[model samples]
Target: MNVMKSTGKFRDESLDFQKKILERSGFGEGTYAPTSLLKTPPNVCLAEARKETESVVIGAIAELLSRTKVKAEEIGIVVTNCCVFNPTPSLSAMVVNHYKLRDNVVSYNLSGMGCSAGLISIELAKQLLQVRPNSYALIVSTENINDGLYFGNNRSMLVSNCLFRMGGAAILLSNLTSDSHRSKYCLKHIVRTHKGSQNHCYNSIIQEEDDDNITGVTLSKNIMSSAGQTLKANISTLGKYVLPFSEQLRFVTNFVAKKLFFKVRVIKSFTPNFMLAFEHFCIHTGGKAVQDEMQKVLGLSDWHMEPSRMTLYRYGNTSSSSVWYELAYCEAQGRVKKGDRIWQIAFGSGFKCNSVVWCALRTIDPTKEKNLWSEFSTHVTN
Candidate 1:
């Protein structure tokens, strides 16, 4: 406190801004933050950063292997994503070393991909499984922003402090025919969109050093606009693959008729009824504002958006892993039926939007599955 006061960094006005952000964040008191960050004078350091990540990442992986009854050696591919914290050895290497995975394991660590990196990792794993027969892939999605908090006076950067909280997930993927019966869901389609070509889009949400030389992720007001535009491009490609022929033809006919009727060269508005393609929606729980914006853009009902909104209020923003938490909420509520098409959508830094579609092989058994939201599931009908 003395050091912060001496430097005239922490001010009374900043407290007001943070307090306002907290009220509208839709984050409950249960949201987890690393103990280091909760300190009066935050004990932010490299060692603490490493400890924070490993605790979440490794613990999640251990629980995954235990529940799945799969040995670490059986994982032929490992993909780990930690957007803000990429160490010298890489997160994948850490998983490899901890699990004592095979020497020939195909491993990768991705950074700077932001919240959408989870779907990117899943997309990569799904593709790899096709070529590498009889193999299993493990993906760990997390954010280690415990030490990345902004202490500077930049309000854009201050948004980061309110938006993110601690969370991680470990997912196992397989391609073996023998494991087919055991697999819960199968990947149907994945669409990735990037708008980084435009300078404004690329700078939508970025990590940089402030004037005080304190580094943090800057989230501009343009983030929602960039996300909405990029998602238009993403679902445009995804629609052809997932939407029924009837829905597709209707959308095109209506779109063209509007343009022709108005004699306008372009139609600035069009959103396919994603409900036609998906039975369940798992939009990323980035924050209250992002969730609210996407809800409007997608024209989703409160029922379809319950998991996302609930996850945000419960777990806060887990970055790349937020979608998984949302999906878990659906499963916990016993809403996933057999043959259900689940749409997982995410918006990230680099002004990227990605969608992963899945089909459940069988009706999920809530008791048999990992019930992350069991406590809330009882009282919450949605």
Candidate 2:
């Protein structure tokens, strides 16, 4: 009787935690879940999970290929990332088999990299393009929420069940300068910070079985602290590439004064105004709390955060693809202009923070674009 009472209290606490999270998560009613998860009892199985990914990846790729009018045979490289739900043949193989890509096509599948895996895929494609000139690389990013849902009474894991929703993106890249005229953006820089060497950071987010033996991903409170540390480390390198000489010099002087000269109290260190480096920022949309924290840390106005905020409200935290969705939101709003620099910041399970920079190659006309939030543009709240 005593054990039963304690278990019931834990269950109640988990339910209360989930309810509170949902109340403040910034998720809208339209956010999605896989058809399988929508069932009365939530039918979870390997077969159903494949169907969920197939429907998303195929639709995303088919739409991209149709809009760009690119033949699958022309794709020389394929990269796909899903933090969970990796199968035997792999998602890259699935894409190749479905589209019948050429036999010589190079493909890779990335897993367990967390929400930052999308930018990682883009970085991978960029490197592949450097070697194979005039080639097109296709990158796909998505998360399988069906496999990640937690029915156990672990309060930490329940946070994911309330925050993540179904979302994905398909991106096409090319090295052919001839395609420049029609390109939307040009890749500029990438900086990745990994903190897995620290035991706390590595264990901050994990998939494990609870006392009842049901498996789910536990999101420790330390996850946010790990993310904050990674962000500082990532921007340290990224700032060198993007910040102007003036900002860089100021940072260096402060570091030298504080560290080398042993006068920490004499000179105050500060975070550089990233706004001066990029016109837009796509902060990782892990949850509303994360966004709120970022807003305070980065000192961004609502205008700068509009794309990321609206993406979260409409799509929830879609894992790796959230950044692309934020980018699409910017394009749909017609905010992308030629020569404008955009920054994508991503945080993942390795306690990693990664940055990807892009410069707009051409002004994006919203009428011709078909973003997930395109139809709702007229009704999107500020």
Candidate 3:
């Protein structure tokens, strides 16, 4: 990765700033850095943006196409999402042009959707697939950290600089019955809950200029509270679809008792045991605090949280792609099995809590060598 080369330059240029952010941020010393920051002149220009896009999106797409043996012309629809970087030609357009896709191929570029945008793109792809039979959709999720780097002294903004890193993921979704036989997982359900109507939720993560006109994404202090509120709302809806009958009954009973029986202290609040619903979890690698809170809220053990923690440590927060890395980690660890349900939950800037439930269609071998987590297998397995 270009990150290793840039580490020295970053430290030499701004050692104190990097040190301070590292001390407080949940990132380790090995998080990926953008090539933009590593450049001699430190590029944040259009060329740099395209380079980053090509390096991640194109590379991932090539690998996906090669593995799936799907030609570029077969992609009926394409959706690419990036929160901070949206060029004039659009990233989707670039992909279409690079791959020489069919002129009628539907393409969309989603921007400013934040980390949860990956699942959002998947949700969109699922909807599109319903309309177009026997078709495939390509989804690319990435963040341009080079352009998003914050040089200002704002602590809230600096946190983003420390937390976010370079990464991307490309996923191919097919609705063809034939492809289903070969697919690793099947999309079961997607639940998206947005709390942006509330002021705090809207401002929880935002891009704005500091007093010195330096731009950065500022994370608000109320992020944790806002995230909790949104997660509660999201899971409440998600529970009805995925939770077992017995768990649903218990949750409803507790909720009713808490609401109707004001004088009784029988139940404070209904916290459904998410562990009962899903066999595995691919929670967004937002940060240490977010992962810790999610583990506690869902009553997950350290084994269940290994993917999120390890992803954060290894890649930092890759924005929308973090969840994919977590999923990949589970596959590398051989934790995902046939018929096992995996829940991917992510929180975004809109104070959105989005979840996608996937059922493993086939067992994945833990000995896969090409996976991103393959290098860290020893550490993860031990």
Candidate 4:
């Protein structure tokens, strides 16, 4: 399966610029410097965080619905993924309440699924659409980093302070047969891989603390490395399915070229050309190292990594919504085209790795819509 057509929506960028934001937010020097949405203090009350989260969620949904020209009442299913801010009324319920979705609308709230939750939710929506044919499904992925901020000054937790940002994203999915022609892309394939180990690799990055109640999560170094391993395994499994014959040929040819032909390309260095297989790549913006390692491992060119790198530089790591920002950037630049393939890869705790493949359904016209990309494009370097 491939992305036939897809669109993403987020809050306007001018509202939150990366540099000035960190300094004013009281974040430690150079902590939130890399991210546009500055991280707030861990002591920041949950109530304030909840309000901010709801505003972004509502804004994102409204933006998506408006762009897709779909009425809120017409959406038959709603799914939201967020690790922070679990309320008595679930996030999905809140969405239903705000939008006044139909009583018959199917809704769910997913918690504790790490960054991979977004991809997992998208896959779940695809499955639901298949079973309940000809229905619209809305999937929202967001993480309120402001609430989860860690002001402990501990290096382990400090990493989160530097990267994570306040952001959310909403997307629409459908199985309407006609949608195959007009929709973004047909739901091609979704691959989920979890490497739960004895050492609590699947442990929650965000936790509930007693007196020392902290909101933000601490992503351990072990969790990061584990994610890389899981992603490699997952993509390999997915590769067996959607990779085109030409891609397979190039992979094999390159492997043989490096080995038997004694080509300058190192035998150990030869890797599958993910860029050759897909026109666009949306790797997770976990960090600079994560993005760089993925580019080196998968043999992706600098151009392929631009969206990921730029998103990280501008928005920091918005967790689940980061990939959507990258995809939005590509669309804004007029880079996406009809029949183009998009590869979205995300890493999360649970030592989880997930990948989704989307192919464009039609050529898209770049629009100067109200989004993070439009404003931050000039600020970012590459």
Per-residue lDDT of model 2, residues 281-325, tens digit only: 998788888898898888898898888888898888999899988
Best by TM-score: 1
Candidate 1 lDDT by residue in tens digits, 269-289: 567888988989999998887
Q: Candidate 4 — worst ten consecutive residues by lDDT sum? A: 1-10
The number of clashing residue pairs in model 1 is 0
C-alpha lDDT values of all predictions: 0.87, 0.87, 0.87, 0.72
Per-prediction TM-score, please?
0.95, 0.94, 0.93, 0.80
Q: Decide which is better by lDDT, 3 or 4.
A: 3
Per residue, candidate 3 scores C-alpha lDDT tens digits across 1-382 of: 2232322223243546656767766777788776677775576667877787789999999999998899999999999999999888999999999999998898999999999999999999999999999899999999998777766666777678777889999999999998878899999999999999999999999999877677779899999999999999999999999889999999999887888887887557878888888988899998888898999888898988988888898889999999999999988887888999999999999889999999999999877535778878767663
lDDT of 2 at 50: 87
Cα deviation of 351, candidate 4, in Å? 1.1
Which one wins by TM-score: 1 or 4?
1
Please identify model 4 stretches exceeding 4 Å from their true place.
Answer: 1-43, 198-200, 203-216, 244-270, 367-371, 375-382
- Write out the backbone clash pairs for model 2: none
Overlapping backbone residue pairs in candidate 2 total 0
Give the total clashing residue pairs for model 4.
19
